[model samples]
Target chain A: MLTSGIILLEGGLLNPNPGLIFWTAISFFIVMLILSKFAWGPIVSMLEEREKGIQSAIDRAHSAKDEAEAILKKNKELLARADSEADRLIREGREYADKVRTELTEKAQQESQKMIAAAKDEIEQEKRRALDVLRNEVADMAVKGAEKIIRTALDAEKQKAVVDEMIRELAASRN
Target chain B: MRVKAISRILALVVPVLLSLNSHVFAVTAQAEAPVKESATAAAPAGPATVAAPEGVAPAEATATHEAEGAEKPGEVIMHHILDNKVYPIEPFGEIHLPEIAAKPFGIDISVTKHVVMVWLACAVLLVVGLTVGASFKSLSSKESPKGMANAIEALIDFIRTDVAKSNIGHGYEKFVPFLVTVFFFILICNLIGLIPYGATATGNINVTLTLALFTFVITQAAAFKAQGVKGYLQHLTAGTHWSLWIIMVPIEIIGQFTKPFALTIRLFANMTAGHIIIYSLIFIAFILKSYVVAMAVSVPFAIFIYLLELFVAFLQAFVFTMLSALFIGLATAHEGHDDHAVEGAHH
Candidate 1:
């Protein structure tokens, strides 16, 4: 056993068997052809299909993100416009209220001045009428007194004194 | 149904028994013949003639030629590793396969152990590949691959992206089928060797050489297709001066052949050496004929080597496919593709 072992070890280790080469080549070639026909096409196409599916999914996600961003921008613009509108309305209301207040104040002042001027004219007319009536009354009283003196046949000095007293009484009664 | 089952059982067991019977018969025949020779030598009482080296060579050669006659550890290892016209199942029997002798060239075309294993590997590849294909056909492409389809898909994707696409570069799709076939075939063959009573076809020099030859042919054909006849011839000069063509041309030619040669040797040696180491380690117990020796040294180391061999099996397949793709890439590369040409080799 040892002798045969040594002999085979020396001679047979590196020896190439031609039969194996022939069979291996034939078998390998057949396998390559068979597998190429049956196996590769389906696998590669399936992989490509999956890849396309993934790529389209990514594309959809991107478009959705863009749409969301656009909506956000639009909403922000709307909010800003509404805020400014509110501010504008408040500012206009305040200005209108101020204008109304000033207009009312000016109208009240003019109306009060007109009422004062009319009352002063009415007082002045009453004072002139009173003066005319008092003057007329004095003149009538003096005529009555002078007629009484002539009927009685009184002295000159005594008649002058009585007429003075009669004038003073008439003036007092008019006041 | 009972009868059908019984018949099925018989169909499986009969061949195994028949082969076992033949192997027992052959062993007795060999034992008796060797005894007769040694007895005649002893009867002659001629120690000098028995010692002659030339007298022994024929007997040894004849013993080797007889496939069932090898008994030594070295002989057993060689018989297992080399191609033979039988499938040996120790203690049972061996199946005597047919041998075809080519007329003019005188080549032996025997469906040996390696041949049978190659066929088995092919059958496996066919079933697995086709099963995956069928699943892909039946199931929707959007669905994730399941069961065998899932595993097959991973292997396919790996070889496509890492091996074929990375190495072959642009227009790599065309070569994916071939590369995928090569990778799976070699991987399955390597794994088949790990089975009991199975042979590693890739461990055989001829088998490795044949695989490398395929790569060689493909590479050269691709080069021819890309560079044309004139450009292909021009590459042999390697862009050297006319004065240096005499030196550079042969070197370039050798370089082309050397890549494949190296590939063949690399795979063959890696596979063969792992088995040899494991076998040698286990043989230590037999040599000492001691249980302690086996338990303490041989069995543990052998087991360790066997595990290492399993890893090596995958690695060698990967390296071979990687190198083949790199070589194909180098050959098919155009002017602008030169940058990635070296990248393939490095990996």
Candidate 2:
């Protein structure tokens, strides 16, 4: 049993086995080929794709945030512009209202002055007509007084007292 | 359901029984092993053979001579460590792997213990690779991979980032598949060796040597592709003076071969040594014929080392993969990177 052949066979932990080596080479290459096709290739690309997806998503988020900020800024500017426009319109409307009010007041003052002038002219015409009527009444009274004096002759002192009494009666009648 | 269960039970039991059968082979192998007279002569039989020198006991211990009580536990240890043609089981018959002859190559391509284990390792890799690949395919770009697929992906990423990319640099993508496959294959083989009735194919020189040879060829090819033939010769000269060519060329060439050589020996010795230590520890109990030693020292120490072997399995695989990538990186590196090319090698 201790034949040199068994020792040679058993002594082979160090020695090369061409058969095993051949199989090792074949199997290893086969494994590398199969795994390259079915395993490593797909996994690596997938992981890389995932990384890219994450990165792009981050970039998209950043851009979206910037866009939102830009829109907000534009809206704020628009709000400020609209506020100024409203203030300008309100100020112009007030100015126009004040102008219209002052112009209307001046026109009212001119119209009232014309109306007062017409009233004063009418009053003057009425006063002049009344004086004419009074003057005619006074002339009629003086004729009647002279007729009475012709009917009755009086002395100089009596004529003078009669004239005074006639004047008093005329004044009372005129009042 | 019952039949399916029964088949499942058979699936588990068969390999275990088959492995136990090797012990029956061990008994017969003990009888057929070297005699006491030739023990010293056949002492240095295997490469890096340890534990046998201490076992100067006779092969035939049946005579009950006080000397015969000192039996050849070394023979038993060798029987366990060495590759065999039969997949021996105790109660059931052994499965004999067929041997084919290639007359042109002068090679015997037989299915030995290590070969079957290598195939088993390949099979394991297939299931794992396919599973991880399937998960990657099924997962949406947004969704993270889960379970064993995720674990395997982490390892793959580690190899890609730490092993291939960091070591090989720019053209690293091309070598990822090769490095990843080698890492998992070697890891599976190392772990399978730790299993009961399992053989470490990496423990075999032919296996590691063939693997190292693959690395060597790829490295050379990459160098040729990257540097061209003139550059390759220049790389062999190591940018030294023409006067130093005699000293530098041979050393540089040897250095090229020695990297793979070291890789082969490092893995082979580590895997084989762990087993040898465990077996040697157990055999010490037998050699002393003491139950106290078996319980207190032998079993405990063996168990401890076995646990350590589990860690070593992963470590050795990582080392082999890391070294392979580093070598490829070193070889394919450009002319400007003469100094910093092997910076990763220090790690």
- In candidate 1, how many Å is residue A170 off? 18
Best by TM-score: 1
Deviation of model 1 at B275, angstroms: 0.7
Candidate 2 per-residue lDDT over residues B148-264, each given as its tens digit? 988999999899999999889989998999999999999999999998878889988889999899888888899999999999999988898999999989988888888888888
lDDT of 1 by residue, B1-347 (tens): 24323433432343234334334444555656565455433332221211223445775765533432323444444556666666666655557787665633677776777889999999999999888888888878657988989988898888888998888898888778888888888889999998888889888878889999999999999999989999888878777689999998887788889888988877877777677666666655654458999999989978876787788787778888888898888888765434234643443
Docking class of 1: acceptable
Q: After superposition, how far is residue B283 of candidate 2 from its true place, in Å?
A: 1.5
Displacement of residue B1 (Cα, Å) in model 1 is 55
* Segments of candidate 1 deviating more than 4 angstroms: A1-11, A113-175, B1-72, B230-249, B336-347
> Total clashing residue pairs per candidate?
1, 2
- Model 1 interface DockQ: 0.32
Residue B51 error, candidate 2, Å = 16
